[model samples]
Target: MFHLLEKRIAETFASCIGSLYGLTVEVQTEQPKHSSFGEVAVPAAFQLARQLKKAPKAIAAELLSAVGPIEGVAAAEVAGNGYLNLRLDRGYYGAGLLAGESAESRMSAEKIIVEHTNINPNKAAHIGHLRNAILGDTFVRMMRAAGGTVEVQNYIDNTGVQVADVVVAFRHLEKRTPAEVCALVAGPARFDYVCWDLYTKISSYYEEHPDATAWRQETLHAIEAGEGVEAELAHLISDAIVVAHLNTMWRLNIVYDVLPRESEILHLKFWAAAFELLKERNAIYLETEGKNKGCWVMPGSAFRESSGDDESKVIVRSNGTVTYVGKDIAYQLWKFGLLGKDFYYRKWHTYPNGHEVWASTGQPRNSSPSFGHGSRVYNVIDSRQSYLQDVVVAGLRALGYEEQAANSIHFNYEMVALSPGTCVELGLELSEEDKSRPYVEVSGRKGLGVKADDLIDKLIEKALEEVTSRHPEEPEDARRRVATQIAVGALRYFMLKYTRNSVIAFDFAEALSFEGETGPYVQYAAVRARNILRKLEERGERLPDFRAELAREAMARQLAEEDCWQLLLAASKAGSAVERAVRSGEPSHVARYAFQLAQSFSNFYHEYPVLSEANREKKTFLLWMTDYFRAQLEHTLAVLGIEVPEYM
Candidate 1:
């Protein structure tokens, strides 16, 4: 609609007063901040004040008089401040909108891989982990809205220090062997939760009792060597923790097409292949002097530096263990098809959507599709790792693989923290600085964060209370099911609402709210639209064929009459929102858009009677308009990993 309005305004300016400056047309269409401002505001006089050699206000006055009549425009008037205010011909615009029903064909798609939720396979997922998964999944949905090829990948840090810490907890503290651990997993307590408590115990113990660090070192070596009771338990305990993480993310609708393990890449010698390329291309030099003696490093900040100058990241420790950064660079090389290497894959699990999930291993895979040959890769990690990620891109550029480097992106976001009240609820102590800040830090090793399952259960219970109050006669099972949908929506949307850079002081009560600026608010709006459509079907007059942007005057008139142009106008920007999300690797924008769309439609529904309007044509027009908003809102929310319940 703005596109149509822009053309009409531009033609009016260009054909009428625009001839003086010989200007063709380039009228901008931006929504005004307040209803009193205008439907769409443009300031051509400001642009030509110097070129036309006149004051902006005088120029605007001339342009207003010269502004020709457009069919769907009620009037084009110059503001007192030299701004051009264009009010649509409400009746004509509404009627025209209803007449044309075809939507613009969605954008042509592009292939994109979203790598996120690379949580350590060491403990149960906490609120911090939830933030990453929710945002990452929403980003994928936003991309797909514009017909993007999105493949979700969950990176598993099976060989990192965090995993080593958990292994230390099991062996040194729990006194459990691999065979005995299998029995323990069959016990009542969830293994992940058990590990969560044990992990924090180990962390606190090691800080106070220095000898505990030695045990961690031993476990690390045992893990790398893949020998002893430590090796056996490492695989079992690691598998259990990873499963818990997967289950937690699944609650938020975060699914993965691949589970890339850091350990598998090491076992398959993919890093070795990457090393060979580094030596072959002479990109990484073998340092024999000064601080980096015996280490391989690519010299040059040709891009950005992770640390100060003269500092080098050690690929191989003095003891021969590979650093995490080194492993990541190798994995990145394989992703771009640059190392000329491949990892063996076996179908570890099948997704709910029926897609097979393949994991990397050294052994041959009997049933695995081709993976890791993507044209582009997006790594969704937090901003603290910005320096390291920058080096990754630099490493590729040094190897003469600039195109691959260009395609690799670091989709970094801020960490999640707990609100003060939540910290007290979870029974965590905080320091002066922590108290000074707005929220409490969620430390996994300290066991100080909301458990994903417990949060979900609480949300469901709360939602059920509200649902029962609204529809007391509904069956208990049905109510529970609907509550689950709303619960997930509320949780997922809250997680996604904040910008990637903004830190949320996640208040459980604040997040659980169903009214005003919330996920359920959006869900409620969508439900109302759906209900309106359902009621319309019950009536004798069938809805006329309509496009999202209809040219007929009647369609435009109908839209304006509903006083809900706010939703129609905002919904039209979904494409632009999706494009920005993909380009910037942020989905919080989409979440905000979804909320705004739903709120606008909801307010309109509350104020306007769709079925009971005095004018039958007015009622039909409003109902048709509601249907489009409903479809777009539902689709966008789903992309944000939110589910609109049948009732809420």
Candidate 2:
């Protein structure tokens, strides 16, 4: 509601200024430094002073006279060197809050495809992978709350070097046949965990004997050719690992609409189609000399200015195998429905929510939902791949899809590391130098990072201890369920509380803390609100039908009070916060808003004791305010993918 009022005020000023001075400019709104000044302040007159060749105060006086009254605005006054200070209609604003209107109302028919959690299907998901998946999933939730038709895609790099390395480990290190590997995948053993260990062993083997790296090349060829035991075993291992990755994500309520596999890109000749387009458009050229001889390279200018061919990116090698960026180019084109080819889709998995996850296949199913062809695409990747992401977008521009290239967003974030304290908690041996540093980086190749499941299990165990202590006589099953919810909430919120570009050295002590700026803190606020109503019911007092009992006049009368007004205003801004977070492409904004709202509620909870109120009318009003806080808190938590436990 605050967001809408701000926009309406801005637009009104823009119209008034344009009509009065015959000038047009973008109007920006901001809050008053002190709440007593007004609700929103605009500085349009300052910008007009330059063009009008008049003092800002003179221009502001004239604009105020020319601008008419705005709906839901009590008064627009000139203040502080031509700034427009606008006060809201308190009665109307309070009434609107009770009506529960959406603060943001952007309706779009175009589809938005968000591709995230593109972990290599070779080993277990690590802490770094958790950061990516959590950020992506939370963004998806935000988009949905903002009323977007979104498709979540999880790109699988089955034919990439990571999957090939695992295959090499199976063939050379473990010396396992295709049948034996299939049995391992089908057995009760954790296949991804096995590959996690084998991957590290293969890394060490390569370091000891560099010549043994040729197996990677051989395995790559077999996988690309889609023939013989190598390809068969590659599919089995990658498919099984993909399921394992999905299960790991599912524990945190992360689900996907499709899994676009690299093998399908090769098998369905997506790269060949993209290659011809690139060649025809001269986006790539065959080099006949220099270090890049016999390679297809895109000019360096597409990504950055260069002095010569050395800066150009290689799309295909001398052996005619396509590079990773080349494959990415094909995938990008398909995302925009420009590849002229589509992946064959089949049912991969159905989540508990009844959402069907589809995967790319060599053969099409009889009935498959249309995938891809999004107006916008957000590829959630870490900051390390910024240069590569640039190259991929450059390929799109070179192919003449300038709009699609521009719409292709790289929602990049920094990597996640473990704090030194967290490393100690994980039982990792730290050197004195490492202990001195703030964080310790984990390497998947060295099998040093904590697995996602292992970390989740630890959080649950810790949460369970807290839960058990809080409710000693509670049923065992209920305690475990509540613990799991709190654990998931803590993990997701910790991953989301940081800005995208900020590196996080995750610490369990900070995340699991229930007191300050944590998920559990915000969640406990909601539970407390609920507990208030529950206590009222237990005391044999029927819950008030707020809609019938609390009239708009009654709400306005109470909201006129300063303390009550502030808390109600804070609780009503959740929708506005969500809109801001979605528009800025930052989930941290939502987290910050949740924390602020929780703090406001905490203050309100202390200041106004609803159950112990002396007056009947005031008590009913306080109860209604508590109800509003609970509803809004849950709505905001849902956007963060955090669930409120029944007995947290």
Name the candidate that leads on lDDT: 2
TM-score of every model versus the real structure = 0.88, 0.96
Please provide, for model 2 over 1-648, each residue's C-alpha lDDT reduced to its tens digit, 9 standing for 90 to 100: 888888888999899888887778888998888777778898888888888899998888998889999988888889998888888887788777777765556848689999999999999999899999999999999989989889999999999898999999999889999999999998998999999999999999999999999999999999999887788888899999999999999999899999999999998999999999999999999999999999999989888866465899999999999999999999999999999999889999999999999999989678899999999999999999999999999999998899999999999999988899888888888889999998888888888788999889988999999999999999999999999989898888889999999999888778666668788889999999999999999999987777776777787788778888878878988888898899999999999999999999999999999999998878998998899999999999999999999987
lDDT of candidate model 2 versus the reference: 0.90
Scored by CA lDDT, what does every candidate get?
A: 0.77, 0.90
Clashes of each: 28, 0
lDDT by residue for model 1 (1-648), tens: 445555566666767655666776576656666766667677778888878788988888888776667766787777756888878766565554444433343445546778988888888887777888888888777777667777888888887788888778777787777777888777888988888888899899898999888887888888877788777888888888877887777777778878888877878787888777777887677777878777777665445444564765566665667778778889898777777878777777776777666777778857667777778889988888987887788778878988889999898888888888878776778777887778877888678888888888899999999999999999999999899889998888888878889888888888788777778888888888888887777886666555533445555555554356655666655555666666666677788888878777877778888788877556656666677688778888878878878876
TM-score of 1: 0.88
Instruction: Please give the TM-score that candidate 2 achieves against the real structure.
Output: 0.96
Best by TM-score: 2
Residue 215's C-alpha lDDT in candidate 1?
A: 83
